[model samples]
Target chain A: MADRVLVAKLGLDGHDRGIKVVARTLRDAGYEVIYTGLFQTPESTVTAAIQEDVDAIGLSMLSGAHLALVPAVMEEQRRAGVSIPVIVGGIIPEDDIPALTKAGVSAVLGPGASAEEVIGAVRGAIDRARREAGGSAPEGEPGGSAPQGEPA
Target chain B: MTRREEWQKAFEKAPLRDADFETMSGLPLEPVYGPADDEDAEYPGVYPYTRGPYASMYRSKLWTMRMFAGFGTATDTNWRFKELLAHGGSGLSTAFDMPTLLGVDSDDPRALGEVGRCGVAVDTLADVEDLYAGIDLEKVTTSMTINSPAAVILAMYVANAEANGAKRANLGGTLQNDILKEYQAQKEFVFPPRPSMRLVADTIEWCAAEMPRWHPVSISGYHIREAGSTAAQELAFTLANGFAYVESALQRGLAVDDFAPRLSFFFNAHIDFFEEIAKYRAARRIWARWMKERYHASSPRSMQMRFHTQTAGVSLTAQQPEVNIVRTAIEALAGVLGGTQSLHTNSMDEALALPTAKAARIALRTQQVIAYESGVANVADPLGGSWFVESLTDEMERLAEETFSYLDDLGHGSMLEGVLQGIEEGWFQNEVADAAYRFDRALNSGRRVFVGANAFTEGNDEDPIEVLKITDEDERRQVKRLAEVRSRRDGDAVERSLASLAAAAADPEVNLMPPLLDAVRTYATLGEIMDRLARVFGRHVEQPSI
Candidate 1:
């Protein structure tokens, strides 16, 4: 079965062009992508992520509220007892990357991230989470497989 | 042979370079244009306004250098405003933060990390007072980019200016009170489309009677284009929204001329130079013709379409940050050549974060260079007669007209109804999403070349620019300030004013402006006022779609 990923836009920023394109990119790469639309709070985003039972969550934050919002999402994930790997992408600055990473973000993609970079980040995060979990892939999902077709 | 035939013969005799001769929007172009291509000979300040809005464009007065600046708290942004004025910025354009834009207070739980993040945070009239501080409201025109809470913000501005001894009539500026685009592009809407549009029409009606110099609605295509729409989509959707606003105002029994003159436009100056220029020209022509013929607007001022332009923020690449200055310069030049009334250039560091002071200065300087150093501003519509430009303008008009026809049929011949129905059906959102996906696919497939992104990607890893950061302290201080204002103000007055505002909101006949002004004067917070209205108007939650 293909890996399922949930992409969400948390916070009040409505700039969804990046997030929508990323969703399509992931879906085109054979991942069953579910997108949570605009104005989603961190609590709502994590709830959707858990409900979807996806392999990973991709958070798109362009409002410059990532530092406060992303950590809140991480905390929500912990509270909900879901150890889902969360990757973020948007207009994130270089200085904020370490902090986001330190706060348990698996990968941080910038605005100019290409399709390969986005796919690589998601796959790497999922792989890292699997390895950390003693190579136990999610129930019926295949463990180590490349995305079907490379983005042309 | 005539001059046209002779020029055609000469044009064919000369060899052309082996290149794709087309406008950025892919409209094919000819090597040279002659009198045969353009025979209208319309001058500036004429009917249809295809050439330019004013007779002596830019030669009499250059376009206002309005920089969009706001971050952290009111005091922080006020300092930036003064600095911009000191640096010769002709006008002020305010950018409210997410919470404020969403009509919530700094302390609201929904605000969480968003307070004072994207733009300035305003809780009450006190924040507005601090925002303007020493800036003379009468001398300078300010444009507030707020939509759902635009009427509330306008009330605060009016109360603040009056408290500062500024007459309401003498005060000048624009309010981006356009709500249709909010449902279509920017998702900061608080109430549903019907009530939200009532707020817009109320503001326009109020401004027409009270603040003549104030522009009630800046029908915007900037956010639409930024949301990944094509150039033609941007033009068509924006003009359709403009027509909707006009219809809304007319429905309110206001004469077309009474409020149409105050209606303005805002467009995105995307990287496609000729395409952006053509969009602006086509915008004026379409607006003029529609207002005169369809709306039966008799006044020439009502027919003219004056717009403010901002350089496309989406075109700025995050890979080579500094190279954005060149991109901004080209876009700003397009705005000036397109005869914009005001302009805002994006900072080099904006793709990552809010612009640092230095980056903002460079962006402002980009506009200064175009206004003074570049000779493009000297001639009104310098590209008006070019074969490529004229043809592109006409093509843009045709494309926009096609969109209007579809919308008209959808609305049963009413543009306003069409837009409202389109928003409900998610047609606009799907169209924009499809366009954005196509662009991304083209970029990924190497069909579209973005410098330093898809091509010429050497040394793209270095990040040298310093981005301005809004610390948590700003948010905390803003919350504390809101609390203090709440505690100090007369609690009874706040309750009474909010009650009256709510009552007025329940009644469709009562214009919400006066009650909003009364509420803001009582120090009722934006959140309180919005919540009261939401009780009656209801909150809007869009049906999420990919």
Candidate 2:
């Protein structure tokens, strides 16, 4: 939890009620949370994520523009040579979760998913990433490759 | 320690403890208040009105069930309005989409893809024509939730009512002409603060002369509370803003009695039941005292507080969409017992989207059940003399007074400056930061219960019912309709009127009312009118952190 899993709101979903709660919730849960304020284009989110070298990325939205936005963010992550796990939370219907996951979302959290579920899902995602990579990931140190010797 | 004890400790330990937790005017609060604390909780109809605004209160009149609605194009929302009216709603509240609020045509590039998304989209007198298609504005008391460009919107309503054969004086309505809260809370403002205040005063002055029944400005705390300020912040800032407006109208050479009686307020009923009830009582006490002491107003009506309340949409959680219904019901109860003149209960689906037709009904039913089934409304100020309510109300009033003095000593009427300084120096931001921080800390520390969120959370949830989606196409179609209005109107006349508006806005001495009326009459689109004012006043440039 050295580096926060920064959650950036992408596009024009001006309603930030849920995201703010999540951001504060995560911060209190002993993780640093950097909320890139409102109306972020996917390009900006990608750039910020790479610069921060976040442990994970969370996107909160109510706007149904997720279909257009998710693919765009995934493409940027692919081009940047980072395979970071991504999570999304909002009023996303069950049917759309599969489509979102197929588009490279690691997990989808929506209505009825509690704070504990979200936190556990996030921690579980990071842990699974570590095990799959064969070790823990290092903090985003300057001029550093992904942490080696102990983690991926 | 118990959960409450731990919370008390955390609140006491907050960095801005002296500033953050204090009342509206920054009055310090003792841990407890007894008979020695201050004074009495008088009978309901007493002078100070700390107990209740009315002698009989809800024993005589239940708060009006006014549905605040408007969305999609005017035609679409008009249908919803009629439906709401048929469902036992006592009053109508109109919510104009952004284009209308900003005085821009739906099709204008700046407003494209934004029309009819948030509220009903109205472009000209024609859309207003479309909006009140079957509804009679003269009979029904309508509330227009508009600010900044309120003068133009008000003119259109006046014109439309006249065309519909309703006498201008016979028209009863409330306009959210409060621009101070717009600058402080809701960012839906067109002109700068000073010029905006001028427009608000102009409306109050003009309405005093012509539209006697019209409450031109409803000083709003709803948006302030929504902007992350607590109950006390909402009360203090709203009352202070009310004072700022009263000062402006006085400067315009209007007597306090002439306009003060019609000055109204709007508040948010968040989930905290006792806190919200205390806020309403505190608001009445502070306003009554301020009116008598500060302005020397003699009329009882001039001093009394009349307000509309809406349940806090912020308190609703998207995590358990259905649970929001309960949240709204409790909030509604608080507003009712607080003696709100009018109320709007948010629907359960608001956490996901705009209330669906079915969900919207459930919200109305919630209010109806409270009114008919519950006996709480049968007696006046039933909880008036309760030890806890009285103590909390006194505490809130004292705190609000303290906040007002701090604001005044900071710099008289420099609201933009205060918020600018607060946001920059991290004073206000830190309060919210710390409050939100502690709230999360509480949840993690198992001191708070968010049932559907943490305690009763389920896994691998399937989809909720299909939500109504408003697409870019909705905006695109709205844009097409608005463009047609622009092309068909008397172009030369609109241009002439808009030029007059520009001239009036530039001159500080000129009361921008008559000229703006001309522009609104000629059907100057929202964008055109805002464009002219923007030239004179310039758009607000929010201060950035150093």
Candidate 3:
């Protein structure tokens, strides 16, 4: 079964070229990608993430609001009790990466991330989350099938 | 046959260099252009404006170097504005933060974590006052890149200038009050397309009567192109939107000449040198012809298409950041050759973050070098007679005309109706998305080469460039200021003004600018004014598609 991933734009930034490209990239890589469109609040994004029951969440923020917005998303994830891996991509400053990583972001992709880098980050984060879950079935995987190998 | 045969014989006798001989957009090129390729191109400032808009071009008055600067608090951005002016920038172009651009207040929950980050935070007229504290609004022309709440922001500017003793009539600048592009590309819209357009028309109508030197709408292709559109799509969609604005103003009973002269354009000077130049030349020709023949515009000023050009932000690569300076220089040169009235060169560090002060100055210096050091400005449309350039210009015109025909048929012969229907059905968005995806696929497949991203990537990893930081303190200070203004202003006056504004909004007959001015004068916040209008007009939520 394909690993389902949720992609969202949190905050008022409407620069969606990066997010749309990433979503298509993930979809082309055999992941069933769900995208929540522009101007999504943190609560709305996390709620969609939980309801969709995806394996990972990719947040795209280009408005330089990630420092404030990402932490809010993390808090929402904790409150919702969903321990999914969260990855972020956009124009993120290097100095802020430590704080974002400390806040539990699995990986941070900057602008112009190659397709391989994007896929690798998501796959690595998902594998880490699955291992942390004691190799349990992904909570919402249909028929409880084990995760399949990466598609070529 | 005599001159042509002689030139052809000479051209065939010479050895050609080993090069791609193709444009950045993959348009095939000829080795040399000659008089045979000429289409009897008009002189500069002539009808159709194919050569250039003004007779002298940059020889008499060089293009205004308008740097887009804003971040942190009003004070921070004001300081930057002063620095830019001191550093020889000819004009000011304001970049409002996301919260302000989306018409939300600093304290609004939706504005959390995004205050004054992307641009300056303006919650009320007070912020405008602080933003231009020492700058003389009359002496300097300002261009505010805000839409959706554009009328509100314009009202603030007007009120701020008046408070500072600047005559409203003498004030000059442009408002990017173009709303159709908001629905199509930028996605910063507050209300539905119809009412949002009404706001645009209201501003145009009000500006026509009051502000003589002010441009009510800067029909923009910059954001459309930035949203991953092809060069042709950018040209077509932007011109179509310009026609729609003209139609809307005419529908408001204003004469074509009365308001059309004040309408301006903004375009993107992407990395494609000849393609960008052709796009500009084609845009002016199309606009001039349409205004004169279709709209029956008699005034030459009404027929002319004047625009400001900005270097493509999307073209700036995050890798090998310094290379962006070279990229910007090439793009800025294209703007100059294409006859832009004003220009803004993107800083090298923009891909990583907002530019630091040094980076911003360097971007300005890139323009200075082109304007002064480079000899390109000495001749108006120096490439006007080139076979390659003339052919590309004609090809762009043909492509844009085809788009106009399709849109006209869709709108039942009305460009305005066509754009509205296209936005409603998501046709424009889908087209842009498909183009963007195609480009991405080409890039991934190594068919397209981006310098550091795809090819020549040795030593790509380097120390991260230092970026401008907007700290939490900026947000805190802005919110405090907002609260202070709210507490000190006359509560009754705010209510009355907002009430009147709401009443005017409900009536399609009343122009919303006067009441907007009244509300801002009473310290009514942007959020309050926008919310009041949203109650009557309703908010717009796009149907998202992949």
lDDT of each: 0.89, 0.74, 0.89
C-alpha positional error of residue B51 in candidate 1 after TM-score superposition, expressed in Å: 0.9
lDDT of 1 by residue, B400-495 (tens): 999999999999999999999999999999899899999999999889999989999997978566778789899999999999999999999999
Name the 10 consecutive residues with the lowest summed lDDT in model 1 chain A. Answer: A143-152
In model 3, which residue pairs have backbone atoms overlapping below 3 Å? none
| Tens-digit lDDT string for candidate 3 (B371-398) | 7766667666878887898899999999
Sorting all predicted structures by DockQ, with the top scorer first, yields 3, 1, 2
Chain B TM-score for each model?
0.93, 0.88, 0.93
| Residue B163, candidate 3: C-alpha displacement in angstroms | 1.4
Between candidates 1 and 2, the one scoring higher on lDDT is: 1
- Pairs in steric clash, model 1: none
- What is the per-residue lDDT of model 2 for residues B53-146, given as tens digits with 9 covering 90 to 100? 6665654467889988887888888898899999999888998776677676776644544567668887787788888888888889999998
CAPRI quality band, candidate 1: medium
Q: lDDT per residue, candidate 2, A54-146, as tens digits? A: 777899766555665777888977777766667888766555688888998878887545578778877776666666665554434312323
Candidate DockQ scores, in order: 0.63, 0.14, 0.66
